[model samples]
Target: MNVLLLLLILSFASTIQCDIHTNRIEDTLSTEANDTNTLCKDHLQVPEKVRIDLYYESLCPYCKQFYVKELAPVVQKLMNYIELYTYPFGHAQMKKNDNKTTFECQHGPTECYGNGLHACAIQYLPKMSEYVPFNTCLMEKWSTDKDAEQCGQRLHLNAEPIRTCANSDEAINLVIYYAQETEKLKNMSYVPYTVINHKVMDPETDLIDSVCATFEKPPQECKK
Candidate 1:
């Protein structure tokens, strides 16, 4: 009975840890939005840095696995050496009728809703750093409405603007645009499709190694 109780407690703790967000990227931003022109200010692009363009859907299991298991740590290690861009459009189809587009997501409506929120984050959030933590929140291990709300609040973002933009017609159009962008990817087959420096990569290979290989002057993290 004691052993069973201990296991239960451990599981509960693990769940809490997975769902919690502390020190989100927004908390560390040296800059904040105070001007309309800079509301979505992008980081300066260095010509010499490597680029990673990620295309994914909100509820793909494989995408989640690749993100949390592979891409997350690799990005951390290569943070200074790479530029990361993400599109939350995957195996989704859109049909236009009467000047409106209806979306058909691979994982259904809930996934579409999730994708909308993520897209809003990208569109609204000013810093690239902020997007990672926000997306990380969306990818919570114990995914729930409570978790989502907590994640947003943790990032010091008001929920109303994000929700409004997500449900708006504009967001749908942007998702469609992303879908078209994904379709343009060469050799595309699945969600979490990665394009490193504008080249589609095999999903089975180690993305970290691939990222390191592209560097003009590989950082110390690449040596490890």
Candidate 2:
């Protein structure tokens, strides 16, 4: 009778241990599932970058007007929320002659020269804070002097580097690069063409509206 009682007690203890092991595995799996859910929720909350690509030339009168009137304000307001990339070759094609590359513009030779200066500004100075004002000032004064040396002087930007870059190999390549970019857009029909988040914006509509519409999480100012 004593031996039988000892065997029964041992069996009961083993059953209890088995139950505890099973409960531990269930608890571990539940914790792991909860952790995965939390990670997925956090990842989904992160915001995506908004892209704005502007293709324009310096001396194109319509492009200049749009820059001054339409784009500047929206760029100033949504600077943080959007990524802006400006390409200064509009409806222009590049060709090689006498071991040097030359670009032809829609407007004229003067427009071509002005566009070169703008490319120089972009190359020599990458900062938008300085480059935007310089571009605006140059556009305002473009009719008087297509070379834009005087505009550089007026804007307090150094003119010599810009003049040097106008005819340099780097500037030529940059303009060519921009021209290639313009060519990639299937619906590109004219200067001042704007693309927002890889989609070509409507020609009849203003791009500022698209900028506000495309943000994944619009800022409070945008809501206003």
Candidate 3:
């Protein structure tokens, strides 16, 4: 009877040990699962965007080429990783005579008008997504009130406000604001002056490569 009782006790002890082992395995698996979830959350966090500034004149052929051929083609891909700012005053002189402010553009009066149109568009369409396409259309075709209206209609944006702004003092002030921003760069001598992350980018360098270099964790578009 003692031997049988001893076997039964041993079996019971074994069952208890199995239960403990199972509980430990379940607890360990739960901890590992929680840790995995935490890791995934960290991995999925959004990263900061790189900043890009383009300082160019509206009538500059090089600016138009850059905007139409180079930047516009890949802008959508980079939008996920970049914050773009465009300054429409380049080599444009603002003079104050007897409290009257006058401006002169390198190209001509037409260039000044083009710059004003761009400034007004930027003022009305604060978002890059909205203004970039409009400006791209302007640069590709021409920078005129008619062109602005056509681009606005193509983009399904209201052109009246932008046209009114362009003809008013608001556009002039916006150009002045951009002039102030552009003057911040000392020894600036050319159109299509590009800055990435507050640093001047060499004109020879590929824009996409320069932009991709700024990211810590580049987006999928950068991989291409």
Best by TM-score: 3
Per-residue C-alpha lDDT of model 1 across residues 16-133, encoded as one tens digit per residue: 5433321122232222311211222222222235678888887888887777777778766777666788888788877889997887888888888777777777777756667677
Model 1, residue pairs in steric clash: none
Q: By TM-score, how accurate is candidate 1?
A: 0.72
- Model 3 lowest lDDT segment of ten: 37-46
Q: TM-score order of candidates, best first?
A: 3, 1, 2
For candidate 1, the C-alpha RMSD (Å) to the true structure equals 17.2
Per-residue C-alpha lDDT of model 2 across residues 1-224, encoded as one tens digit per residue: 99999999997886665555444433443555434433443433322335778899878888998888777777676665666778888888788889887878888877777777777787777776667777777777673344357767777778678777776776677777777877888777787888887788886787677888887567765766
> The CA-based lDDT of model 2 is what?
0.72
Q: Which stretches of candidate 1 lie above 4 Å from their native place?
A: 1-47, 141-147
Model 3, position 197, has a per-residue lDDT of 77
Instruction: Give me the displacement of residue 126 in model 3, in angstroms.
Output: 1.0
The global C-alpha lDDT for each of the candidates, from Candidate 1 onward, is 0.71, 0.72, 0.82
Candidate 3, residue 78: the lDDT equals 80
